[model samples]
Target: MTKQAIEQTGLIPRSIIRTFDRFRIQLLSGTEKLVIQEFRISRYQVLVSVKCLLSLIILPILINCLLKNFLVLPLTTNFWNTHQQQIFLNSDQQNRAFIELSQFEEKIYFEFLLDSFNKNPAFNNSLSSSNEASISNQAKNKSPLKTLYSDKYALNKLIREDIQRKTSELAVFYNQESIIALTNLFGDVITFIIIGFLIIWMKPQIIILQSFLTESIYSLSDTTKSFLLILGTDLLVGFHSPRGWEIFLELILQHFGFPENEDFIFLFVATFPVLLDTVFKYWIFRYLNQISPSTVATYHSMIE
Candidate 1:
């Protein structure tokens, strides 16, 4: 009974382990000469590691948080504040204002008010005198029900016109805002494209190294392969990187027993790119032949 209990206790839970023991054992089987060879092949690997750490990991979180909290959130909040006022009556006008003035009711009231203040008096005077004249003329043209129906129909037409005009103006305003937002997004795309091209021109080695590492790691595990496939597919489908990826990556990290604290999340984000770059550098230097210091030379030779 004691032996069976001890054997059962020896079994490790998959969820608690950070990495596969087999992977670690295989990785450590290599000798010290391999490390020296790796170092000789890529001395500038540290630079790439630093660049990835600063750019991919740290910068993204900062940019995301700052833009969301200070810029995007604030801008949207201000928009809500401005637009919300249009739908509700002012506090000072509470006594005079009709309670719960829905769009349809508001339009009816507005048309009625305008007619009463601006045009109804002259028409009423004419009607008052015409009532006496109308009685004298023995006009069989008048019916109380017909008059009431005509007045109601005219009032409804006036209200409909007013509502349509106001709604159309609002639609136009929203359309203008949408166009501006799209234009700004286009501008950002152009800017990023230029920057990306410049980066490819300057440090093609980093891209090549990271790509190779990603491919290797993705093949090593089904989980990694699926995650990377989803990420790549999203990018290929033209999804926004911040919206599509950042949250996904964060969730993956958290699910893998990573700390949920804000500072740790930021640090993880900052360090993740560096980890990838370092792994790539290690693999290239350890497994492959030494390449030239200059990326242009390497690129041109490859093209040939």
Candidate 2:
């Protein structure tokens, strides 16, 4: 049934998929498109090299959407309707049974009162001091509802205790399938996160290569350089150590007794890699140009 539905209408259009592929290739290849061409490397190769990391991001989203649409919504609705109907019927029956029991208890209490009333007034006055004190306090209040509530409270306490004793019997009525389904959902999320972390940790170099491309055609402004460097650094962290680097930085700050939640400090920690990478790369580029200017010019010309 699911296959038929999927075949009838695809998730996304072919044209859109193609456009996305082209955009990713163009973005990642950067000014290195010329270099890639000179080296006879196919753009498809570039895409496939990072496909696992890309899948780590994409597959979970697709799975969540599919599960919610096909499994969770439909199965949960059907299960609720079927399971809850029986529970409600049993609850109503239990309520009726309790009401009958309460009525019988009230009749016995009323009979005792009448029997006591029939006794001598002197004998009734000679009751225990504790019992007499409680009766007098209740009489002073003069609220029938309060007296009724006191009786009902005792009945409710008994009912609660009964339920606790019969917990195993009630356990059989629970929806185990729903519990299992939710557990599986949680496991699926955990697996997704683990896969994401593994992808970053195992293929750090490839992920960095996919982040940015060399551009020798034009002189980039400081702001553009900073932005690109930061973007590349973010990609490096995301595809290398995932949240490990961020957590490490936060831990270090905490260890030094620095305020971990300060916005400026967090921003500085986040961008530190970008600053360091940019400076190091700039120095390398300058040194290479000084030592072998012709080679650098030739390489830039090929890229252009």
Candidate 3:
């Protein structure tokens, strides 16, 4: 009864179900790795494990590069303080400033957009002063979204054009300054392509390795859920420390049953995400492999 009730509880009642429902295949299987002698890693498993690891390793690398060039090199560590001293950063003074800026941009854009429409000549450019004024008045009363399309009120149009131009300028400035766009998805593609090719050149090994990972995820899911149930119960009722995962490792004994001493809260919080991500990513790959093996195989072949 206790086990059944524990299995059924999560953040939401069906939280566990929703998580597993997305997977198209059983990731872990009991029969995946036949035991004859001691366990050994397969060729396919190594490739897949490395493939899964690139995203984890690359993102942090890219972010570090970006921060070094833009923040650390350019502004040191006090950029936040610099930005806050600017008038734009003064929240109490910003309301009036924002209104004035909006009005200025609005007037400039109205003329610009009206010129665009006139060149397009969708409407006769022969409207009377009174009619034009009425249109302008209507624009002022209308919402910002509606005002953009209006010929007489082109604030939104002008603002968009100005922003586009300025953003391009910023991009060019960073390029010239050697800030180096630290983020290029092309690197990821190339890394993956090399991996795919390596795997294709070595298929039987890759397949068995993939099968092992799939089986591992399935087995781990059940084990993880049980661990979570016990952990969550402890967290909910026990004195969960803000920093317990670091300490909890030593406390977790593979004895007959989970030992209950004092509260063991900090360990769960720290370790939950790392454990969750390991499960989630493995599941994602396993799911993709199941749904489109032909396509994936072809891709792997080409890259190889």
Candidate 4:
């Protein structure tokens, strides 16, 4: 039975018919416009095309740097300096900070002790000697050695003072890091806002840019396209991608001053890459297979 006859008989819903009609019209219109734009860009001079491509790529990057370094960073730094607070956003951050600080303190103390030992001639001579008994006797009798080894109370006081100093320094360091994180967050926000405005303002240029990129991609050899697809997929969603995801997640969390929770990081690492891999597979199956079946075949062979 014809769709029109079925619809007229009320066997098919009118809403479903309307929805499909609208979708069909929109899809055809969009595809026609895209094809026309591609043809138009293909008629441009080589120099004009290159200039358009370069400006599309470089201008946004340049603007992002200028906005971030000159505007966002300075403002955030000034505000942080004016009203500083040494605070962690959560208990996890606090614990992580102190654990890192403790490790740093241990390393510093160990280096200090090693330097002190190297500078002491008597201790060096005692260590160099093969006579263990003589070394023990010298350690007991020597005043310098006694001061270094036997003065537990003095050593404890020195360590206590150093710890207090380092604790204060850790607080200052944490405050500075918080400001840096805020600066990064604000910089990203401003950059995205500028990009959105540019997209609206330069709608024609944006269409030309999309056409340019599409033409460039399609012009490449099938092998090159396959290689690029393989490289991108491996980097983003392959077996080794979990470590990369972990590091990326950590940096993002630090940038937003979020607590670096291991559970959340692990969950993201496990799920996001699988989702991304599924997307890549779908793109390969849906678009690449239709557009260039040879490239899809080559990509599969390369994967094997």
Candidate 5:
């Protein structure tokens, strides 16, 4: 029968024909890639691969460091110092700072009293003499005992002065932290911009890098892939992931000068991991099940 007549009869499935066409195109593309790769000198291939790796990995890191250290850090530090009162971002952050400072003040007060008692020579001598003295002698010496150390009101004043000092220190610490966080956020933004520019300018190199990475990953052993998959899923979406997510969210919020709201953190922890887990499961069911059933089976067995 003529091909046109057979097509009119619809004897062949359209899906099969489409799939065959796709396979043929992929085969031709792959053959072209292999031919190019084979014709290239080994040293040239290595150089290209190295260049791609450096652009993908080391270049971004270097740019981040340069921006953070040279640009963002000094600018943020100067701004934070100049506008110390404006550093907290909001009242909630300010409240948290004071709360932490109060707690620290209490700790310092207790430690200061203990240290004073331990280190005061007069107090030590009075204690030693009291142990040697009788009850009557102790009663006699009770009035003079007040003189053995600094006056109570004087100690209170000193404590207040120390607390004031600590308050200043705490303010400096908070400002420094805010400065660092701002620096990181700005550095990240600039680094992303630079990387985006690089990606656009070197599109061909980026494509080659992606293809190389995909081929390398596919060439990995099934057991290795399954192990990596299990490790990644567990780290991202398993039972303990909530704590990790909470910490990560807190850091992210702090990096952007936001208050670490417990409600927001908990909400994100509750939702994001579940969504991520769903995505992982969907990928496993829809793609991995077709591409590497054995790896999927291995993953299930290992997880179980």
Candidate 6:
């Protein structure tokens, strides 16, 4: 945070400008001679470095993809199908769902009649006859289907309540496997985030060490400087300070108020994308929201 950077940042809206020109001074005061030699890395070193990078990044993605295609997706699908079929095939359970659906239709029809009776004068006049006729028809036609859902006030109320209860029961039955799967998925995600945070925090010692060596190279000279540079270069991988991806991770952690300490992981992994995204995203959204409304409109318009 320098005056120059602040001034420059002020000139452009944060919505449009995603990054700032960061300046870090590697040399100390009272020293002026600083030189940086762009060292070329050999193909072998480049390949080895890339291999390490892939291990850090690609392995997780690969594992997740394989699990999704070969294990998780199939297991979930099979469990869901079998669980649903079992619940449906159960005589009591399936009958309940059927009874529930029938009651729901009856309720809708009754509501429609009620609403019509309210607004239609003719319909209102017919309501008394309709009720009495309905009772008489029920007395005359005593079929099993009619008996099951006869318009006896007590039976009707009881069935309606029972149907609602059964509907909820069926819903819970269907969602049982889903709940378990979600729990397991959530656990796996939390595990990975914890592992990632721990690995990054521990290895940052090496990363910071590498940064120091490479950044220090720009400020030294003479035999001691050359010796230091040679020593430093041998330790660093071509003066590259942990890739942009590394910085991205660090920023993500920081957005969650998780500084690179020597313990635990980020603030929490209780929720996965929700926290990772909210810790960074919604605040940025709030910032943009606080900015000029025109900018907000423009930002959304740009996306649209």
Cα lDDT for residue 261, candidate 5: 86
Q: Which pairs, if any, clash in model 2?
A: none
lDDT of 2 at 147: 42
Question: Which tens-of-lDDT digit does each residue in 109-207 have in candidate 2?
Answer: 565455544543433443544686777775675445444444666556655665555543444333343333443554456557766676677575455
- Off-target runs (Cα >4 Å) in candidate 5 are 1-46, 82-87, 90-100, 115-133, 144-150
RMSD of each: 20.8, 20.4, 25.0, 10.0, 7.2, 18.3
Ranking by TM-score: 5, 4, 1, 6, 2, 3
Quote the positional error of residue 106 for candidate 3 in Å: 58
Off by over 4 Å in 3: 1-42, 65-73, 76-214, 220-225, 232-304
lDDT of each: 0.49, 0.53, 0.47, 0.77, 0.77, 0.49
Per-candidate TM-scores read 0.30, 0.25, 0.22, 0.69, 0.74, 0.28
Residue-by-residue lDDT tens digits, candidate 4, 222-267: 8999999988988998888899999999888888777888999999
- Model 3, span 169-206: residue lDDT tens: 54444332222212222233344555566556657655
Total backbone collisions for each predicted model:
1, 0, 15, 0, 0, 0
Q: Provide the global lDDT of candidate 4 against the true structure.
A: 0.77
Least accurate 10 contiguous residues by lDDT in model 6? 30-39
Superposed by TM-score, candidate 3 places the C-alpha of residue 161 at a distance from the truth, in angstroms, of 56
lDDT of 5 by residue, 2-91 (tens): 464222225675558879986787677577776566668544655676798797798999999988998889988888788565655556
Better of 2 and 3 by TM-score: 2
lDDT of 2: 0.53
On TM-score, the candidate that comes out on top is 5
User: Which lDDT value does model 1 have at 278?
Assistant: 69
